[model samples]
Target: MSHDILRRHLRDLIDAYNFAQWLKTLKGLIPNEFICKRWTSEPNGFIITPIDQIPGLNT
Candidate 1:
């Protein structure tokens, strides 16, 4: 329902699907600075950080 909730759900799905690795792969293929900038900017806007950077994920 709400936009914020929907975004969170989507983000959770992405995380569940291991989308960060996909993003990194896509970024590598594209070789665009703007894409890299956009990817890095997302966490500041959404409270979502990379799963790999999370403490529990590394364990």
Candidate 2:
């Protein structure tokens, strides 16, 4: 019903849901994909900005 209550219920089933294991499996799929990208917005974090705004990234 509420955010906290929903999160608490999900937390109890973390193992049953295999959340961490599912993430690990997804991580392994990254390399299998043909096209992979790591575009960055600013110095610290990764966010996608318009090409015109981050023209420095243009190659």
Candidate 3:
């Protein structure tokens, strides 16, 4: 999705995906796992972990 489209639809998308709370909870997580395993092949970088893995995700 385009940045503009993503920006405009963020709220709707979050609600539709049932990820609003997940996103909020993940905000504090540490980067332990890769968001995508293949992401490691990229020159840039990527990271992922369970939302509950975050320091305060359960709060």
Candidate 4:
């Protein structure tokens, strides 16, 4: 495998292994876990409406 592929794979695997070993050390968002991360990366222009704006969610 190419160096780039090996590097990325190794990074993700290492982070996963470390996170599992010390899960209690993580109190916030988990590393390599991406959702807002995806939204931040793409090229788009949609106002990130606050979750509080959802009429039913607040109810």
Ordered from best to worst TM-score, the candidate numbers read 4, 1, 2, 3
Tens digit of per-residue lDDT, candidate 1, span 1-59: 89999999999998967766765777645334444456587756545444444345445
Ranking by lDDT: 1, 4, 3, 2
Supply every candidate's count of residue pairs whose N, Cα or C atoms clash at under 3 angstroms.
Answer: 0, 0, 1, 0
Local distance difference test values of all predictions, in order: 0.63, 0.52, 0.54, 0.59
TM-score of 4: 0.38
Candidate achieving the largest lDDT = 1
Candidate 2 per-residue lDDT, tens place, 27-49, comes to 74442231122233242443533
- Give per-residue lDDT, candidate 4, residue 19: 79
Please provide TM-scores, in order, for all candidate models, with all chains considered together: 0.31, 0.25, 0.20, 0.38
Worst ten in a row by lDDT for model 3 = 29-38
Error of 4 at 40 (Å): 36
Candidate 2's C-alpha runs over 4 A off are 15-59
For model 4, name the residue pairs that clash: none
**Which 10-residue span in candidate 2 carries the lowest summed lDDT?**
32-41
Error of 3 at 26 (Å): 0.3
